[model samples]
Target chain A: MRLLIFLARRLGYSIFVLLGLSILVFLIARVMPGDPARMAMGPRAPEWVVERFRTEMHLDKPLYVQYYYWLRDALQGKFGLSIYTRRDVSQDIGEFFPATMELALFAGIIMGVFGIVLGVVSARYANSWIDNSVRVITYMGVVTPAYVFAILFLLLFGYVLNLLPTTGRLSPGVPAPPTRTGLVTLDSLLAGNFTAFFDALKHLIMPGIALALGGLSQEARITRASITENLQRDFIALERSQAIPERVIMSKYLLKLSLIPTVSILGLDFASLLGNAFLVEMIFNWPGMSRYGIHAMLTKDLNAIVAVIMIFGVIFITVNIIVDLVVSWLDPRIRLGAERAK
Target chain B: MAEALLEIRELHIGFEVYGGTLKVLNGVDLMVREGEKVGLVGETGCGKTTTAKSTLRILPMPPARISRGEILFRGADILKMGPKEIRRVQGQGISMIFQDPTAALNPVFTIGEQLMDAIRYSNSQEALGRREIRARAIQALKDVALPDPERILECYPIQLSGGMRQRVCIAMAIATEAELLIADEPTTSLDVTIQAQVLRLLGNLVQEKEASTILITHSLGIVREWTDRVYVMYAGGMVEAAKTREIFARPLHPYTQLLMRAVPKLTGEGIAEGIPGRIPDYLNPPPGCRFHPRCPYAMPICAQERPPFFPRGEDHQVACFLYKG
Candidate 1:
């Protein structure tokens, strides 16, 4: 019951934040120096045609009026049409957002799992050659941005070594899985197509690694530092004195105690990945929303830009809320504002 | 005579600090016989806690090093024991009641789960059924004077009060039925009234179970009331050690005398006066006796050579030039 109440409060705050983001993005996309209608129609298009497009979009109305209709339509799940694609912005997002979500989800798995494991390993072997190596690797991972790793990885492995496929969501010849979840790898597994599943997984690896490396290294460093500090804590000494096996101490006690900060960092990293994904998706031609978002921004596609921004905002808020819930679940100290369900 | 339950001999501990080694424990010797309550008392940072933690060998390495020591438990050299042997002896042979109850028990685990962890680690109780473990956990809590042991088992550490949490820790220490219990400043974090109650409870439990203990604290009153023997540490060196009554009755070392003077007596006296000099820096400690800089009767000879432990009375020893003759 307490968890539910806490979740509700977090969800309420997320809604308020999303509302603010929507207004901010709506204004910023308009304020930028470009005409959405002219970009949608070519520069040689007739003036009457551009004017007609603007009126139909309610761009002729007052800014506030335009926002009001935009918000109302959005709340009803109708994002206005993309100026360039002439397709419903919501529909385009529905198709494209899943790809980005898949990349982020897979990357999030890599980031969280490897980050924590490496951190714990480093801390356990603190000051040893192994620990020093981990520190060096994490430092390099952090200093060099994720896209640099992506490009290097592409050249070295994708082109030179010919180890993994670098481009597209699935192989051209392989029939795409029946479009259910929109994440091709998962959908392929769901359809019991092991070959397609492996193929989709192959395509995911490079981009996922590219997107996850920075966050992974960051998590490892933070986890190492936090766990190292926690290891000094009295409880650890007490546990050691109690003769608990070293494995149990690390797996259950030390890891659980040290992981709260790591998980919190992961929340922010996942949200930031939405922005980072633009480059990775473009490089790999993964057909995620980031690609669509970049195309929208270049053409001054107002509806598309606002929709994409709002979507990112929503995702960011949701990740934070989930992280909060997970932290509270893990660290009983943070479980506040909930009556103990007696 | 029967073998000592725990013996820490000529122990020298230091930290490999930024500039140089910080000598924390210097030529300290302590012994706790079976069923005896020994108090290792001193001001904070005097290595009273270090001596206690050393027996378990849980102090962090790199920063901490036991340069020289032989800790014998049940005639086996703890210092020479490998990791596997050390693991066998830690909870089964010796248990520790930590200082801070707030941070000692994990906040995530329930009171019951924490208690069960101790019971499970316990060699004797590991073979018991689940029902038997639960019953013993409840019994352990009851032994510590905790009410509603069953309900508390489900509640998280955040739900428990400081005293209650400490009682839970006490429960864990006692649950294992380990031969030696090292209560390091156990009551320092409790209310005065609660402190007395806890000390009394601890005293009773030690006596009833016939378990040896090393109570690490700065409380002279507790030592006087509960401990059979007392070792007074000063700047990581043992200044004086004697029967609790003997030390209080005639504290020969100036440091020990000053420590007794600082304590407020229940009867008439001026406000407690602190000792004149501060604790010496471990990295660059006073050359001779670590306490000589603060010694009221510091002769020129006191700065030249460290005072040997002089036998004073029945089982009484003082390391001060004043008592050398």
Candidate 2:
């Protein structure tokens, strides 16, 4: 009962936070020099064309009017039309958002599992060759720029090795079949077209691996450090003296204790995965939010840009709230007094 | 004797330091009866804890090496037991409460979860169903005299006071009714009032369970109040052993006498005079008797050769050159 209330309170706070952040980001993106009216007008457009464009985009309205109108329309699921594509902003997001979400989900799983396993193994064999080797790899992953790694992966896997697809979500010749679920991989599998599913998997491999690589190292290092510290604690020693099986100690005690910090980091990493996907999308020419967002920015599509930013904001805030709830659950001490009071 | 519940024979625990093998426990021998309360007393660095860890086979590996020892629990050498056998014995035959209660319970776990885990570890089959486990947990909490066991079950360790946490630890230790309970300075971390409460609680629980306990502490006062028998360790060796009252009333070894004098009494007017000189460095202890350098009645022979246990009275032994002849 208390948990439900706590979650409800957190979710309410997150919505307000995301709403506020979206407004701020919308204003900042607008203030960045380029006039959406002029950008939409193009080089050969006349004064009247620019004026017609401003009226159509609602740029002629006051700043406060524009924000209020945008917020109201956004609530109603009308994000307005994209000035660049001359299409509804919602349509653009609907078309591309799921692909980004699927990629992020896959990367999150890979990073979370691999990172925790490596961390446990490294901590268990601390100061040994295995520990040193993991540390070295983690350092490399953290220090190397994401774009550099992405380009390197593209060169090695996409260009030179030719083992994976270089561009798009599926093969060029394949007609993208029917979109039942919007997610290429799942929809392909649902269609029972193994060949199409395989092609989608190949296309997904490079980008997912590139994004996961950065997070995996950090997660592994954090888990290793946390577990190592936990291992030195008195409770761990007491547990050992109790003659609990090593497996029980690792899985039940150490892993559970270590996971408190790991879970929080994983939540933040999942959110960051969305941000990182932009670069990955660009490198692979993947038709996802990053590509759409870039086009919106270049063409000064105010409604599309605001809509995309708001969606990202919502995702980030929602993830953070989930992380907070998970942390509280994992560590009962946090809610002890509160439950008693209730 | 029908067979001691726990027997440590010629146990030698040491660690490999940069210099050489630093012996922590040198040929230490002790035994506990099935339901006896044994007080293992020593100053810091006297290897009392190392001896306790050796019995549980929980000593850190590599640097901490048990050079020679046979830790017999119910006539079986625990050191020779495999991992699985050892685990079965742990929490079933022997359980331990550590010095710091805050550090002893996992911070992430609630007092209830930790207690449940310990209970499950001891009797997993019986603790199978959640309802049964919850009932047992409540009973365990009640046994420790915790208020509102139901509410406390939902509370984390951090929310509880130090005294409450220690009680939770004690409750978990006794939950299984293990044959032996090793409490290493369990009350040292609490305040005087709480310490007394914990000490009394431990005594009551030990009696209730009819279990033997190895209470390791440096305070002779605790020895007088809690233990049935006392073993005084000086510089990695047992200097004296006797019934608690007898040892306190007529301490034979100089080290034991000095330790007894060091205990501050509320009835006394003057400040307590602590023993002089620090514990000898274990890296390269003095030859002969490790205590010879500090012994007031040190003889030439005492400085050259270690003294063996000399019989003093019924169930009394002293290791000192003065008692040798």
Candidate 3:
């Protein structure tokens, strides 16, 4: 019951945040020296046609009036027509959102698991050759962007080794399973198409890893530092004196306590994956929402731009709420204190 | 006196620092008898805590290395025990209560979780069921006089007051049924009003359980009131050891004498005088006696060689040239 209240409070705050984000994007898209209608119609189009397109788009109205109309339609799930695709902005997002979600979800898992495992290893063997090597690797991981890895993996795997599939969500001839959730891997699995699932998973590997590298490095570094710090804590001594095995102390006491800080940063890292996915998606031809959002931005597709921004805002806030809930679950002080605060 | 439960003979521990090793413990000797409360009293940095930690073999090794010594528990040398054997001795043979209750109990885990883990691991060979462990935990909490055993078990360490936390720590240390307990300044961080209560609780628990304890502290008053025998440490060495009453009545070592004088009297008579000069830098400690530079009764021979334990009376020994006879 207290959890429900906490979630409800978080959801309420999220709505306000998204609402502010919508307003900011709405005004910026207009004020940033571009007429969406003219850009959509392209150069050499007659002046009258541009004028008519502008009037039809409600672009000639006052900025507040335009925002109100856009918001009203948006609340009803109509974000007008995208200037780039000439499709409903909402429909475009719906079609593209699932692909990005799949990649982010896949990459997020990789980042979380491998990051922690590596971090534990690094911290356990601190000051040794293994720790030094991990330090060097993580340093390189942090400095290099996701797209660089994407290109490098493509060049090496796609061109030379040809070990993994480097393009799209699945092999072209395999045929997509029914678009139940639109995440090819999940949909294929749900449909019991093992072959399709395997193929989709294979396609996901390279892009997923490339996208995960940066966030994974950050996670490992944070986890290593936090665990190393926790090692010196007195509870560790108490655990040691109890004759608790080193394994139990490392996992139950040290890892659990150290994970709080690492988990705190995870929401931002995972959220940033969506923003960072634009280049990775484009390079891999993944048909993710970030690619669509990029096209929308290039053409100044006002409704599409605002819609994409709003969706990102929603995902970011939602991820934060989930992270907060996980943190509360890990720590009883936060769980009980949250109730007290209420 | 009962047979010795633990004995540390000529223990030398050093820390590898930037330039040189810090010789923290130099030929220190201590013995805790079966079912006897022994107070290891010394000021900070005097290696009392290091000695206690060494008994459990839990001191961080990279920085701290035992250069020389044998720590025997039940006639088995602890320093020679393998990892598996040492683990068996920990908690099952000897458990430790740390200085700060708040820091000793993990912040994230519940009182039940931490305590249950300790009990479960210590008795792993028994294959005890979950219900048995829970029952034992609740009983342990109850033994410590906590208000509600069930509720306290569910609460985190942060929820409890310092005294309560210390009580919980005592409960954890004693729950393993270890014969010997090493409490390193257990009440030092607690409130003054609560200190006596916790100490009394510890005393009662030790008596009730027929368990021996090595209480490490800087307070002579605690030692005088609580312990059977006292080993007064000075600059990483055992300056003197005798019956508690005898030590207060007649402090043999000059450092011990100064430590006794440093305690403020309740009558408001003379001011408490702390010993002059600081503990010598361990990196290059004084040659003959670590405490010689500060000894009021320092002699030429005191600086020439380290003094061995000289018997002054039955069950009393002091390391000072003045007692060379």
Candidate 4:
């Protein structure tokens, strides 16, 4: 399809972003205070053993040469040894990435759907009390931090009211569902463990709400503004003059035409959710890759930190490409512009 | 006139602004006879477009308020009609094509989709099949003399030229077979050559459809060439009204005479001069004659009190102190 070619071009740009991200991650891991080889050998290790470990780990080489070796090994899917976990960085990531994906996807869905609906309703009833009330609520949501909300929910609902769990992915008695997909909720359903499935879902609600709040409000504001501007366009006047049903005009013409900017914002919001979700994950004790990254940061684990950044870079780029494709599909002018350029 | 198709009587309109109400139209009267082309010429912000929009009852309220007036279509007041009643007349009894064609069309839709929508609105009485609407849309395109109507249908509005988009807008209005068609500066957005072509196309199509047309333009040349009657407006009130030839030959009001002098001749015998002063600020418009500030023959009464329309000739009227009863 013509759109496939557009996607291919976007994919090329995303790959370039990943490469830049890889280099940055490599440098950041090097600059942080801690010798990975010494840390690995331990403080009590003999001097010769520490020296051997440094040479083996390429600490003795220049930074560029070390980067080259790391890049080469990385390109082959070998992220090297994690000093903290004593496992391959890629293997640890393989386990945590799915959990992160599941949480982020759920939060994103909540943000996109509720955010856009609130925006449309607000714009539809602009200046009414309902609109004013919704504006106030969304503003409050936007100003509150995700971790603050997480802590609040934990205090109010989990600790005080005793209505929900405070932290942890599942209760002590509930077993982690058998790992087909590694996403607890989905795997629980696959294993027909209704009890575990519900327990996992209960744990997700607080953190999910926290993670979704900021994106939701931001998306709503953007959607409201874009749609309000679109409502005043000359084409809307044309549609009204044509005597097309108001329902059809609002849905088929107004909403679809106005959503391009909103969709673009949504894609970027999805990418940002990764960084924000890290806090939600930490506060709520959700086991996601970001939590693992946090652990690596505290311990100054080199391979693990680099690997996490690279994975995040990949996910962010992928989201951006999908968004570009969706936006192009919404507006035919983009494709026409491509043709003109050609 | 023989059973006027549309008549607007003593129409007053204003906008609610921050500090005060901005009066856009003050006691404006207009009449369009069956199958007659009437030109409404005015400077920008002279309430010409507001008057046209009021006829359809489509002006955005709060910002636009009809303080007092009656807009009558076929002797029935449109202001009194409910939404359903208005809908019946919107695309069938009356339709409007706007100034900027590109802005008037939704960019996301294909030409065919928008055209089909218009066709269905016009053919609402008959539950026409998709095939019938598609055929009529194509036929409407062909009527506008647009080439490759079939291929053009699939193309988005951005792909079409400015002139082609104007043609599509014209086609949509004419295809409805509405009794009264309103063209508000339909050629202003195009280049000079394209402007003439679009005007000619509009003239022919309106004549063929036998629809009464209300052409609002800044160009006096357009008014003289296309209209049977012309109304010259200044500052929210009608300055002069007469048959096109009569107005050009012997314009009664001083504003009308000055407007005639503003048009340049092709031979370039004399310089064409523009009228002095800007349009009055609507919030505090000149109390009496809205054009009194710029009138060469302004009398004491022209500023102290407003001039009522007085008959100058058969079916001709001018609002000025020199002719008022």
Candidate 5:
């Protein structure tokens, strides 16, 4: 009962924070010295066209009035028409959001599973050759920026190696697979054409690996440090003295204790992946929301930008809230304090 | 007439320190019969805890080298057992209660979860279901005299007070019905009153279970009150071993005498003088008798040759040149 109440309260607070973040991003984007209507019309357009465009885009209204109207429309799921595409912002988001989500999900899995395993192996063999090798690889991953890695992967895997398709979500000749749940990978599998599914997986490999490169190294390093610290603790020694199975000690005790901090940090890493996906999307032309957001920004599509930023902000906050609840659930020490505060 | 429950024959534990190998326990011999309560008393840095850890085969590996030791449990050498066999003995044949309960239990798990895990580890093949396991857990809690076992089962280690946590630790250690229990300074972290209660509780449990116990502690008073036999250790070596009354009544080793003098009396002026000087560094411990430097009556031979155990009376053994044949 108390856990339910606590989760509800946390969810309520998260929504409020997300709303504030949205407003801040929205106002900042508007206040930037750019006339969306003029940008849309171009320098050669007539004055009347620009004026009419401004009014239609709600740019002629007072700042507060524009915010209030936008908030009301957004609450009703009506993100006003995009200045560039002249389509509903909701429609644009609905089309591209799942693509971005698919990339993020696959990248997150890569980062989480492989990153943690490498970390544990490295920590368990600290100062050994294996530990040194993992350190070198992790260092290389950390130092090389994601875009640089993405470009390198593109060149190596696409042009030089010819192992994967150079660009896009699928091969050009293949028909866009049925969109049952909107994720290309899932949709391709659901459509049951093994050929298209493999093509999609092949295309996803480079971008997903590019997205995961930096975050995976960081996650692995963090897990290693946390697990090492846990190993030094007296309880761990006591557990060993109790003659608990090594597998149980590693999997049940050490891994469970180490995951609290790792999971929390991974949540933030996941949110950052969304931000990083923009560059990955541009490089690969993946047709995700990041590509849409960048196109919207360049064209000064105010409604499109606001809608994209708001969705991203909501996702970031929701992931953090979920991470917090999971950490509390896995470790009673955190939950007891939370319960007491309630 | 019955064989000893645990026998340590010429036990030698050493560690590879920076300069060279440092011997922590040198040819220490001791025995505990079934159902006997033995107290191993020593100052800090002595091999008392090392001896206990060796008996359970739980000493830290690599640097901690048990160069020579035959730890026989029911005439079976524990050191010869495989990891699985050794583990089976741990928490089943002989369990241990650590000095600090707070540091012993995992902070992440509920008290009940930890208890059940330990219980289940010791007895998984019994096919006890979750409900049955929980009932057994509650019974274990009740045995430790913890109030509101159900509430405690739901609470984490941080929720319970220090004394209550110690009780929980003791309850878990005793739940498996091990043949021998090695409690290493189990009440050192508790307050005086709580310490007394825990001590009393331990004594009663030992009696009820009819199990042998090796209580590793520094307090001679605890030894006097709770144990049947006491082994006094100084400078990583056993100085004396005897029936508890005999050791307290007539301490043969000078170190033992000093330790007895250090104990604060409850009824008297209570001004007790603690043994002066710190324990010798183990890396370069003295050659002959390790305690000779601290012993007031150190003879020339005491610095030259290690003294072997000499019989003083029935069930009494002292390692000092003064009593040596």
Candidate 6:
């Protein structure tokens, strides 16, 4: 019941956050040095055709008025039309967003699992060869960009070795599974097409790893530092004194305490992956929304730009809320809002 | 005489650090007879806590090394015990209550979870159910004179008061029904009024259980009030060991005598003189007696070699060159 109240309060605050985000993105898109109406009709189109496009889009109205229309249409699930695609902005996003979601989901799993495992291993064997190797790997992973990893992986796995699919969500000959979640791998399983599922999975491997590496390394570093510090805590010493099995101590006691910080930042890391996916999607030719978003920005597709940015904003906010819930579930102090002991 | 429930013979502990190996405990010896309350008294950094932790083998291994020692519990040598055997002894044969209650109890775990963890792990022989373990946990809390054991079980450690946390720690340590308990300055972090209450509760619990205790403290008054025999330590070495009454009546070691003089007397006039000079740096401690530099009665031989325990009277020993004569 208390958790419900807490969540409700958070949700209430999220509305304000989205509202603030919409206003900022709306103004920024309007102020960018381009006329969406002229761009939509092309440079050769008559001036009157561009005027009609401007009036239709409400681009001639005051900035706030334009935002009010955009918001009203947005709330009603209409995001106007993309100037570049010449289709409804919502439809373009609906078609493309799922591809990005699928990649992010796969990458998230990779990051969450490998990051924590490597971290625990590093901390357990701290100062040894295993720890040294993990430290070096994580350092490189953190410093290097996702695109750099993506390019290297593409070159190594695609051209040099011919071991994995380099482009698209599936092989050219393999038909896509019926769209259930728009994630080809999951959709393939849902459709019970084992061949397509394996093919989709194979294609997912390189890009998923590339997208996950930075966040995974970051998580590993955090988990390693947190666990190493927690190992020195008096409670851990007390736990040992009580003869708690080292395995039980590490898993139940140490892991739980160390995961608090790691889990809290996880949402942001996952959200940031969506931002990083733009280049990765382009490189892989994965047909994700981020690639579409990049094209929209280049051509000044104002409606599509606003819609994409808003969706990303919504995703970021929603992820944070989920992370907050998970953290509260893990820590009683946050769950109960109890006073900390001196 | 009762059989020694725990014995530390010529124990030496060191910490390998950035500068050098810190020789923390140098050839220290101690013994706790069955059902006896032994007090290991020393100022801060004097290896009293290290000694207690070593008995349980709880000290971090890489940093801390028991260079040479035999921690024997009942007839078996603890240092020689395998991981399985040492674990069996810890929390079952011997348990410890740390000085700071807050740091001792994990902040994240509920009181019930932590207490039950001790109860379950210590009694791994019996496959006790959750309900049975919980009942025992509630009983343990009640034994400590805590109000609402049920509610407290559900509460995080941060929810309890300093005294209450210490009581809970004591309850957790004793809940295992271990034959021996090591309380390392258990009341130091508590309030003065709460300190007495906690100490009294601890005393009562230890007495009721018929469990032996090794109470490590810097407060001479605590030793004078509670222990049967007291050991005084300076710079990682034992300086004096005697019955509590004998040590207060006739302290043989110059360090022990000066330590007693340093304690404020309730009836005596004016301020008591504190022992001058801090404990020596362990990285390069003084040769011979670590206390010779601080001892007023320092002799040429006192700085030449470390003194061994010399008998002063029946069951009384003082480590000093002066005691040799």
Best by DockQ: 3
Residue B50 CA displacement from its true place in model 5, Å = 3.1
Residue A103 deviation, candidate 5, in Å?
Answer: 0.8
Q: What tens digits encode model 1's per-residue C-alpha lDDT throughout B166-215? A: 88999899998889999999999988878888888888899888899899
Per-residue lDDT tens digits for candidate 3, residues A1-342, read 878888888989888998899999999988988778889998989999999999999999999999999889988989899888888887888899999999999999999999988898999999999999999999999899999999999999988999999889889799889999989999999999999999999999999999999999999999999999988888898899898889889878887889998898999999878878999999999988877888888889898889999988888998899999989888878887877776
Query: What digit string (tens of lDDT, one per residue) describes model 2 on residues A47-147?
Result: 99899878876789888888888888888999999877788989989999988987887788888899989988999999899999999999898777567
Candidate 3: docking tier? medium
DockQ score of each predicted structure, in the order shown: 0.70, 0.58, 0.77, 0.71, 0.44, 0.75
| Docking quality category of candidate 5 according to DockQ thresholds | acceptable
True contacts kept of each: 0.68, 0.68, 0.82, 0.60, 0.43, 0.67
**Over the stretch A1-342, how does candidate 6's per-residue lDDT look in tens digits?**
766777788889999998998888888888999888888899999999999989988989998889889888888999998878889988898899998998999999999899999999999899999999999999999999999999999999999999999998999899989998888988999999999999999989999999999999999999999999989988999999998889989999989989998899899899878889999999999989977898888898888888899999988988899998888778877766632321
lDDT tens digits by residue: candidate 5, B228-315: 9999887777889999999888988899999888878887695988877678878888878988887889999998999889999898
Worst 10 residues of 3 chain A by lDDT: A333-342
Ranking by TM-score: 6, 4, 3, 1, 5, 2
**Candidate number that wins on lDDT, 5 or 6:** 6
Show pairs that collide, candidate 3.
Answer: none
Residue-by-residue lDDT tens digits, candidate 6, B1-325: 9999898899999999998999999999888999999999888989998998898998999899988979899989999999888888985999999999999988788999899998888875666899998999999999999999999999998778899999999999989999999999999999999989999999999999999999999898899999999999888989899999999999888988888898888999999998889889999999999998988889999899999999988999999989896
Model 4 residue A336 distance off true place after TM-score fit, in angstroms: 1.8
Tens-digit lDDT string for candidate 2 (B16-82) = 9888989888889888998899999998889988888777778777779988879999989998998
Docking class of 4: medium
Candidate 5 Cα outliers beyond 4 Å, as residue runs: A1-3, A46-52, A123-128, A228-244, B15-23, B123-135, B148-151, B265-271, B299-305
Off by over 4 Å in 1: A336-342, B1-3, B83-85, B124-126, B265-269, B299-301
TM-score of chain A of 6: 0.97
Interface RMSD of 4: 1.2
TM-score of each: 0.94, 0.90, 0.96, 0.96, 0.91, 0.97
Tell me which residue pairs clash in candidate 4: none
Error of 6 at A256 (Å): 1.2
